[model samples]
Target: MREYIESQLARGRGYFTKEEALAELGLSAEAFQAAIGRVKRKGLLVSPRRGFYLILRPEDRQLGAPDPSRWIDPLMKHLGLDYRISLLRAAAFHGSSHQAAMIFQVIAPKQLPKIAVGRQRVDFLFQTSATFEEANNPAWLSKLKTEAGFAQIAGLELTLLDICRYFHKAAGINGAAQAVHDLGKNANPRILAKAASAYENSAVRRLGYFLERFGHNRQAESLKDFAKKAKSFKALDPAVKPLVAELGLLDEKNPDWMLIINVPVELEA
Candidate 1:
């Protein structure tokens, strides 16, 4: 019964699955179909996905009305990304309140799976291990990093270094800028040094070169300096040297937030 569904949901986190319905309502196959059909048509429950449902109340979706956009969060939990809406997705979430929620930005390690939840695409990025300093700065970044598997929260400086390093791969330069400019001090250096020590490649050096440009007297600055001293990619890894050499370094100070490294224009910019 509707009263039973409400009573059952009232006790927990406001979500119920088909199995939950089976246990509570004891509906046979046809009865279950009719009950679900009635609730959904009345706009009292929303089907987030195939079997999972959320009690929409009067706030968002009407009861029983399935909103495909609501599928990403639960999907993320199922995949163990422990993801949050961050980066471009966060910006979009902030920027367009009325827009359809298709794309979700999240922060999880590289080990997580990539998924296209309905129309929204969920992506993943790898974060390096962080020291004590990087973890507590950006309220959002810190909280995001602490989400289950992606717990190595980097400081603002370390995050900036990472953004610059993976600007092209993770969120691109704009995402990198958003990661850095939104937060103030967490962009420290000592955290980045540890990252640099592990991220030995041309991509990292190019990012390090740019980040070293914006760096203050932080620990990552020293690490960036060391990364710049890598001379050529050949001295580092034999495999990535050629790719590193292709993306040249830029020393000119331009707030353009551009990637000076040369890649084909058709590449994901």
Candidate 2:
């Protein structure tokens, strides 16, 4: 079993499924399970998902498995799921490295529990297939090369919008603001406006507020027309409880973007 796994690795394949192993080894189900179990016990293989196994090279043993970026493409293909690297993970790739990404973040059509294997962790954020397809414009996605292969990642504009849309998961409003501050330098105003059109108006408003607060006025201006059209005001940080409900005081509102500043945002120099 070890030799077979090694040969597969040699052939440039990093992973295999249980069915493939059973067939290739010509073993009964019970026997194959026992054989694979032994390899796993020896730290030669790690399974991030059921029925799938990743062979660990000597260099990869320290990390317990290959970096998620190295195999995410093939793994997503194996599971028959469409995905793109997104949120904080995608922001880091775009040079918004203010906050280190603690886990790999992915956007997929279906919801999934987090996957943790050794030191590697991956979190999945959900979107409907229709919504994901509509937002996954070719111009907003890019192929990023990794040690094992290439993985699809959100482009600058998409990354910024996704971070705001999922701000709670991306480390709240301040975290989202930090990413905006870092990424704002290279943001293309025209492309950002086009991308914002695909997301909810609230997220567009939050993003615009962050951009203006972080001194990216031009980029903020690009999103102004779209944000101003929002039917209602949205909290700058959706996670914060409304001050109106707590203290019976109206929250400071940014009329330009129509956002209720429910939380304070602090940015680093």
Candidate 3:
């Protein structure tokens, strides 16, 4: 039985309930505790949460805590708010290495709402909106959300916007830039444009500027569209029109800000 548990731990599927362990080990609950204690003494598992045990190898957790998605799902369903992990949290899920990120950012689309778990680093954000922000992308739901009501995952542009809102924070700018760089290869024109559509959004404009410097063409164009959709830049942002004009990117048909936001990078097979 110990050998079998060790095998499952090798596969990176940690997190099992008491009953699960008992049945798997063919032991009573009391025996299960003894077994767990033995495993703990051997340094095979770590308790990321109470009653939850995960086998630990070098870089991955085995029998890790239940998927963050599983934990947040019932809660979100209870609140009836469609949410997803956004910003730094999403970037981390996608595997961009960064430092100093402690809270989980969640988005609902209408307004920014936040919750802080006591003494735990996990945090939550829910956008209070007339309509919950929705992600048609299935990948967003399954892999991006986390365990702590942290579910709202933002599109690339929205993430940039999300980051800008928190730019005043210490890790905000670096975290945001790292995210952009991580996705620098993935920001397709359409997704950027959609995310840029929320133009009353000041931080998004900053992201657009950053994209321009970094050569995100699609994102640049989306930024331009965001400006145009808002019906002019005089009061919204004085620099916007001038910047677009300097780029000579005005297209009555498709006035992208001319960012060329993505540059392709090869991934080896």
Among these predicted structures, which one has the highest lDDT?
A: 2
lDDT of 1: 0.46
Q: What is the C-alpha lDDT of each candidate?
A: 0.46, 0.85, 0.50
Q: Write the per-residue lDDT of candidate 3 for residues 166-214, one digit (tens) a residue.
A: 5543154455555665565566666665644443445555566556656
Report the poorest 10 consecutive residues by lDDT, candidate 1. 143-152
My TM-score estimates for the predictions, one after another, are 0.52, 0.93, 0.50
Model 3, C-alpha of 267: deviation from truth (Å): 24
Model 2 lDDT per residue over 1-269, tens place: 98899888888888888888888889998988899889989989999988888998888898788888888888888899988998888888888768666668999999988898988899999988887997888888988887677999999989999999998888788888999989986889999998887888999888888888878988999999976587787777655555445875445878888888877688766
**Candidate 1 residue-wise lDDT, 1-269, digit = tens:** 58867785566435567776788788887888788889877766655456766565564442232232344445445444443344344433334232223434345543555544223355666553352223223442442321112322333444454445445543454455444444423344555554455444554554444444445335324544554455443221223436756654332222222223333212222
**What's every prediction's RMSD, in angstroms?**
8.1, 1.8, 10.1
Off by over 4 Å in 2: 243-245
Clash pairs (backbone) in predicted model 2: none
Please give the distance, in angstroms, between residue 85's alpha carbon in candidate 2 and its true position after superposition.
0.9
What lDDT is reached at residue 207 by model 1? 46
Prediction 1 TM-score vs. true: 0.52
- On lDDT, who's better, 1 or 3? 3
